[model samples]
Target: MTAAAVVLAALGAWTDYPELVTLGLAAAATLLLAAAWLVASPKLTVVREVRPRRVFEGGSAQGTLTVTNVGKRDSPPLLVTETVGGHRTTVTVPALTAGHSCTVSYPLPVARRGRYVIPPVELGHSDPLRLLHRDRAAGGELVVHVYPRVHILASITSGGPQDAEGQTTSSAPLGGVAFHSLREYEPGDDWRHIHWGATARTGTVMTRHVVVPDEPRQLVVLDTGSAPYPSPQFFEEAVRVAASFCVAAERSGLPLQLRTTGGAQRESSGAALEFLCTAESSGADRGLAALADLLRDVVSGTQGVALTVVTGRVDTEAAQLLMSLRPRLLSVSLAQLVSPDNTLPARPRGVLTVAARGSEQFASNWNRLVLR
Candidate 1:
């Protein structure tokens, strides 16, 4: 357009046409005014609010942005762009008079599990010609946590050894303080252990039998090595399996320890879920060695600790390593994500292995296991 205006001005000078010169001058004045309009800064305030700061994977979250013109004079309509989870969406804000505000709402993407940061909204000011524009950031960044999907199972039985007295397993170990049952008093029974009420009712001396308490502890190891998984989906399934195990253990009142390539923790279910949300596959093969160290340390300190390992794929070397841990662990289980038609090699005698295509199948197979 600038080139055309210059040509018209030159033609008007050569042909001595007053109308052509006036038109060229008017075009130039219009361009100058548009540039000045775009160069001026916008006098507006922005505020953003995110609903349900935490959400599960594949869920939906919404954000509302309110833009207000603080200047006494009316402001031009502007464009507001927001970035969330690495994606950007833009909305048009209508012209606002002094002390007036316009609110716009947008849906945030939650297809994956992780902590996403929503940056400040960018306000774009431009002229009516749309030839020039300026963008200014407003407000502050907000963080939202996306947790993995947790499935509820009917029951999760401990695979550890049972008591010889045929006592039912409990979440905590039994002590003499916890009363179990009363039976006929034996000659060597302490007088304090005798139940006077039972003896009076049955016309025989009865002694209280206090069963020993047994607390189950489980260690969940998640392999995040990048070399094993054939696709990202498999790795994601592995994470979900680990998260499910954590949730199950927590609900069953069992002490659980979670180990991943990123790190390890023995906190509550919330902490474990947070870790899984941000866990990523690593190219290094250090997870196996880390698992071995963790198993050795845990076994040396605690006896009859149950262990479960989750991985995307299993090869001869990985299988052998898992098999070797069976001796030190009271019960060892392996969950591998693979194709439905894939056949795994024979597992070790004491090691329980379950192969499935996804998290749902894996949970079904795990729940059906009859661990001795």
Candidate 2:
């Protein structure tokens, strides 16, 4: 347009045409006006808020963005770009007068498990003709945690010895159905537990001393070593399996401990789930060694602990290490997530092994185990 206007002005001067000169001047004025409009920048302040910052897989999350025009004059329409879970969304904001604000709300993606960081929003301002524009970043980054999938289990039995009535046998003489000693009968003593022979010989009423069994403790270990998993998908499945077990244990009022190759060991279910949300496969070779140390500590510090190890692959050496700790543990169980075509190893005498292709299959196989 500028070139054409200059040509017309020159032609008018050469041919002495007043109409051509007037048309050229009008064209120049339009160009100047467009340039001036584009040169004026819009002053805006942005504030963003994300609700339910933490959620489980397949859940939903939402966010709101407020944009205010703090300049002295009315502002033109602007484009706002938001980033979530590495995906971008663009929203158009209507024109706002000074001291006026507009808000936009959108849903965030929570299709998978991980920690997602939402970066600062980008505000784009452009002229009416869109010939020129500028972009500036606003607000701060926000982090959202997405936890893994959890499946409910029917029962959590350790498959120890049981009596005819289906009650689990106690290993200690004091805390089980077995009689530990005889004591003088108390006012509230059950008549069924009375020792008639002791009472007749000593001329005093005596009762049997029996201890009640305590609930079993479960320790869940997740293997995050990259070398064991031929693919990343198997490692992810292992994480889900570990998370499911933790949830089941907590629901059943079982004492639960979670240990991961990333060196996270937490007793609270909430803390364990949080750890799994951000856990990643480690390429380093120290995972197995760290796991060994963790198992050793568990064996030395506690008794009657039921061990459950979730891993992508379990080699013979790993199996041997777990078997060696069987004496300290009440029971040992292993869940291995393998490829569809891969064959599982034979189950050891003292260890229960469940092999499956994914989390659902592993859950099915686990529920079938008869834990006492």
Candidate 3:
């Protein structure tokens, strides 16, 4: 049709025929008007649904788009494009039958950990003459959360409990859970501390002071505020720290609790990464609430649980709340982790400030603390 119009216009221009020009103009205008009408055409009824609301990097999911033709006017074939997270996929919805419905399905390969909003579907339909096209946004958006990949770790450590004396306490004798060895008792020893059989054989008295292993009840609290926009790399570095801390504590069979002031859903061993990745950094209260929930289920046994916080900023109120839990905690702010020029938190005797470097620095600092 366009070729014919171009030929007619050319012939009119060459031979001075006015009818050919008028006919060509009318034909071109009709095609354009039809195309505009089709493009401006309202979607009869369009709906979208997403599956697997949550996914991990490298995981795959699907979505369904249902379109029903309810318009009084019939239309030709239309091409639909679905854009998500800067990626685009196209589908063709064939010419619809009146009152008929069609569903289109597409796959989304989860490649990164972040929230994604599916963009509106742009539908393009052209006129029968194929000289013009109409386009319109067809559907609402679907949101998906993609969590990052977690690297498993065991026997990780952040630092020592700020106060050793504060963690010690005398309680009812615990059976089969002695963490320390005993010295030869010189007679006035508590009978309960005596290994009767051994005492009888050695004919000696002995006493036991609760053996305190270097591993203390350590709590790693991560502050996940995106206020200043923590670099993606830095965010992941913090996650690795949280995970490593959990793994290290767990590996030593020390009572360990993984926490964050960013989101709930904390896990002891298997839940470290999920909690870290899925937890959102909306506010400190939200994050702390989530961390508290996680702590509720934690069983640290007899170890003196220490609190080590990893966060961007120190909420004084939050810190005060934590202080009530233990006299003092070894709070390490990542920004202040390294020092010389950086300002440090007020010298809370137990709190240690350390700055985070690259991956290598993170590992080295972690290793030093764990080894120490």
The TM-score leader among the candidates is: 1
CA-only RMSD, every prediction: 9.7, 10.3, 14.0
User: Which is the winner by lDDT between candidate 1 and candidate 3?
Assistant: 1
The better candidate by lDDT, 1 or 2, is 2
Candidates in order, TM-scores: namely: 0.75, 0.71, 0.48
Badly placed stretches (over 4 Å) of model 2 are: 1-43, 70-72, 97-100, 154-216, 286-290, 370-372
Position 105, candidate 2: lDDT: 88
Model 3 lDDT tens row, 1-372: 678778888889789999998888887778777767665564477887778877755687787888898876664677888787888888888888777778989887567666787877888777666667666887777788765543343233435533333344444233334335556865555667766666677777655655333445556677566432245455555665666566666666565556665444353755665565555555334543344454454333454455656554445655554445443333333322222236544323344444554434655655565457
lDDT of 2 by residue, 1-372 (tens): 788779888888889998998888877777777678867766788889988888888788888989998989899988888888778888889999999999998888778998888889888887776655777889998998899988766545664533323323334334346565688998877888999999999999998877544446789989888877779988888899999989988886566899887787898788899989988888874555566787777788634678888887777778778788787788888888888764765465688888888898988878776442
Regions of model 3 farther than 4 Å from truth = 1-15, 36-43, 72-74, 151-218, 222-372
Query: What tens-digit string does per-residue lDDT give for candidate 1 at 1-372?
Result: 677678777888889998888888877787788888876655788889998788888788898989888878778888888888779888899988888999999888877899988888899878888766788888998998888876654333555443445433333344434556677887877788888898999999998876554545678888888766778888888888888888888887666778875466655677888888888898865766566665666778544577888886667676787787777766788878876554663465667887778888888877777432
lDDT of 2: 0.79
| Each model's backbone clash number | 3, 5, 21
Q: Which ten residues in a row have the lowest lDDT in candidate 2?
A: 161-170
